[model samples]
Target: MNKQFIVNLPVRQLDKSKAFFSALGFSFKAEFTNENAAFMIVVEDCIYAMLTTEPFFQSLTGKPVARATEANEVVLCLSCESREEVDSLIAKAAAAGARIPHPAEDHGFMYDQGFEDIDGHLWNLVWTESQA
Candidate 1:
């Protein structure tokens, strides 16, 4: 069965968040995006990230959103085809105002790194060797 997934994140500024992600080579679905939220297409039609305004997101959850900068929330990870791709993407993210929390790590079969976006959302980029 085919399934679609969406991860919602609250951002203080919609346009700023959109620009940040766009600089990192992400595209948003115009049909689902508007003034209050942007539907970021992470993986074709299967995976997506909804960047929403604080008030709009709050209305959906009916609770106070977690302060991503001060609290440990979700860590969204994306897989890359190679170590170079992982490093390249991290560089783009940094150039787009993302904060690098640490250096990349090489663990034999995997190489990984992480960055916090403009909204303080943590994201991990990883490249893993495929076993034959």
Candidate 2:
């Protein structure tokens, strides 16, 4: 069986975040699409918990969402088959409206970059030496 994983993210604007990931070629699973949130399919192995602002998500967690710049709660790491793939996704994310996390860095054995979604969620795109 294919084990499924889900990551819930608090978003100020559901539609905006949905559109952003959509631009990056991700599609929502219709069954999980709703007014409060949209389930974004990152890949067969991953899913995003794209939550709406206010009562929708707040009521569930009973707390404020973490600011990406202020916290290091978690960084979602995803693998790529090659360095070019990591580079491509970073470019695509910038075009899709995500704030670039940092300049691309290399460590001889790995390459990586990232961006913050509208909701302050961090996605780490990586390409390892094995992939290179």
Candidate 3:
């Protein structure tokens, strides 16, 4: 069986959040986008992130949305094709107003870097090499 993964996140402003990810080269599905939420396509049809306005998100969950800056909820990680891709993405993110929380780490076969988006969501870009 085939399955798709969708992660939902609460954002203070839908348009701002959309622009942030767009600057990183991610596109949205028009059928799934609206004023209250934007469906960001992470990997074709397999992976997607729903960036919903805080109020809209709260309406669905009936709970308070966690302030990503003040608390840790989830860290969204994406695999990169190469170390250069990882660095390039980080640069784009930073240029788009993301904050680099820490320096990139090189662990022999693996390299990774992290950034906080406009809404303070943590995201990590990683590249791994097979040691065969």
Question: In candidate 2, residue 100 scores what lDDT?
Answer: 91
Error of 2 at 42 (Å): 1.1
Q: What are the Cα lDDT values of the candidates?
A: 0.94, 0.79, 0.94
lDDT of 2 by residue, 1-132 (tens): 677787777677788888888887788888878888888887766445555654677788888766665787688898888889998888888998888969988998998998887666788998887645
The window of 10 residues in a row where model 2 has the poorest summed lDDT is: 46-55
The residue-level lDDT of candidate 2 at 80 comes to 84
Off by over 4 Å in 1: none
Candidate structures ordered by lDDT, highest first: 1, 3, 2
Runs with alpha carbons beyond 4 Å of true place in candidate 3: none
Q: Give the TM-score of candidate 1.
A: 0.97
For residues 65-122, what per-residue lDDT tens digits would candidate 1 score against the true structure? 9999999798999999999999999999999999999999999899999999998999
Q: How many steric overlaps does candidate 2 have?
A: 0
Clashing pairs in 2: none
Candidate 3 clashes between residue pairs 3 or more apart in a chain or in different chains:
none
CA displacement after TM-score superposition, residue 62 of candidate 3 (Å): 0.5
Error of 2 at 107 (Å): 1.7
